[model samples]
Target chain A: MSVPFYDSGVASGLLSGILFGYVLEAAGFGSARKLTGQFSLKDWSVFKVMFTAVLVAAVGLYLLRLGGMIAGNSVYIPTLYLWAMAAGGLLIGAGFAMGGYCPGTSLVGIVSGRVDAVVFVVGMIVGTMAFAGVYEPIQGFYFAAKGPDAQRLPDLLGLPEWLILAVLIVVAIAGFVLGSRLERARGGPFTAEDVNGEDTSKAKNQNTTFNTEAGIVP
Target chain B: MTSSPRPFWPPLVAGAALGIALLISFLITGHGLGASGFVTRLSAQISGWLAPDLTTANAYFGPFLTAGAPLASWITWEVIGVLIGGYVGARTAGRSRLMVERGPQASVGQRFAFAFIGGALVGIGGRLARGCTSGLGLSGGATLAVAGFVFLAGFFIAGFVVSALVRRAWQ
Candidate 1:
């Protein structure tokens, strides 16, 4: 029933990573402007793609667990560190906003032959080194508010996992609906034509209008 | 390029494909997608080689040494795959080009500066959170880990606020 190579961590990691990277690039996430579009409300592709992926994976994993095909504990779930996670999230968000790329997307950017992405990756390495250099001082805050090992929402909320999943599905759908409306209000949904080639003059014009409307002088 | 580049796949389609990839990862590796961990390990390993005493004495980079060769880890191979897959995807679509992406008004220097600073912040933050968007946001969220949602909330909220302030960078 099980694939022999699946047991090999290296092989599986490479297989999964290729799929993951291909999907990211094909989704246009290789472009920083396209990704930061979410923050500007100009394009909902980032939100749509991310939410869809989350919903599908969550549901699929849950079903697999229910079917006893995958043990519940086999999948990795990160420990809950409320303060560390929150603070870290804030910093990452700021970085995302300022940098126009995340760790994953930045890699896609590099392969897409982006110089900025290369710089970003170099900076990322330096940042990690810096954190290590200062880890001793911030060790307490980094590990503060540690919760139960591998805690999930259901565990924290005292609700059935299925019920939470159902609710999340509804929420995601609603978010999509809202996202569409927001895109419409801004101008229109961003399309592949916007980033497919050198013919971005039209897209550029549209961006100008959106920025002007948003009260930013570009 | 002479011909127009191919358009990217629709968001929903690509998202579904990514989800399936994630599911497969779980079925095989018993974990989901990740990126920052690889960078951390690589950095730690390199630093270990340069200054074995300092790297091992540090609280953060020290632990990575115990896990054996950093390049031999699962995440390391996965990240290498990411590079290969990304290159293939870009090449197939004719989207591969050497350029610095930025707002029209933003100078090249500005873009580079922001990109580096932003990346550094992401590295620090990802290390602190023990995951990045892919590792924590997507993987943790799918597992319904409270840490995942919490990180997502802070990420989006700060993203909105900061992007607004730095709108000129990528408007």
Candidate 2:
């Protein structure tokens, strides 16, 4: 396929990035407290946002391809380097749990003026260089960490991708239901404003709100 | 006499917005979303800048030298937009507080220290795994990639484990 505008990905990427950032910030993902809420199960916002996005994209893309709206990228399914992916994900999760941001989300935090997010980004950059420098020393485990295949699970299982997507959507909806009930049980009777952590008056009115100064309604 | 701005959107709603953005991305370009690749490219460029011969000669940086302008990637630009968009989103939501996000128990210096270490882990992990949350979790996951689920499973399991150890960071 002919590349779109050859090298003007600047425009495409910039506009998309802008939208991506705007939505992330709107979700309150820029806040570490809000994000970490998932780890503690204090707030299900992170899980809610993430799974919802996954469901939408998975279902939407599958349908789009079916309808032939988007022919789709050739390597739609990423290669499953099982061990590397597992190890890397674990480490990144540790980072996310501790730093409260991923590379993409950290950008949102930095733009929103979180000092720690900035520090995290800096550290990631340095770490990338360090990893590159050490790449040669550990090629065996890193390079050879392959999964059974690089295709989507549906492809491997001989089912339609949309079917799995449907299954995922069902699971996500169930999760959403469970998350809501849990939230109510954890902190009863929260208004939209309190959940958003935007009401200054509410914070002022209550000495011991559910949330701390960071906005994870304690 | 004004309505309160929602501190954030409903996750479903916000996720819908994200879904649409991702759809547009696939429509226009045959790519999903990513963030760590930009950092890798930037690192290569920096290495090139610092030691022109090193970038040209090193194993990791050498391939980048042949791959045209690494700095002008879509992901790099997207991240730049992330910064701008994040600022706008935070301000719009009335949640743009410029401070370190740490638990009451953790000090500023300690929080920043952890932030750096955690970030470094992410960097190495992204490289080792060839993607990050946005890249692997969302982009690849959306495609029903098996690796996506693996990353997801690994991410949560390890995240929970580590959180147990460093519970003080964000108590």
User: Which candidate achieves the best TM-score against the true structure?
Assistant: 1
TM-score of chain B of 2: 0.91
Instruction: For candidate 1, write residues B1-171 as lDDT tens digits.
Output: 334467788778988998898888878877789999988988899899999988888888887787677677888889988998999999988877778888768999999999999999999999999999999999999999999999999899999999999998876
lDDT score, residue A134, model 1?
90
How many backbone overlaps does candidate 1 show?
0
Interface RMSD per candidate (angstroms): 1.8, 2.5
Per-prediction TM-score to the true structure, in the order listed: 0.91, 0.88
Q: Which one wins on DockQ? A: 1
The local distance difference test score of each candidate is 0.86, 0.78
Cand. 2 Cα-lDDT: 0.78
DockQ of each: 0.70, 0.64
Q: What residue runs in model 1 are displaced by over 4 Å at the alpha carbon?
A: A2-8, A199-218
Q: Model 2, B95-169: lDDT tens per residue?
A: 666567777789999999999999999998999889999889988887788888889888888787888888888
TM-score, prediction 2: 0.88
**Of the candidates shown, which would achieve the greatest lDDT relative to the real structure?**
1
Root-mean-square deviation per candidate: 4.6, 4.0
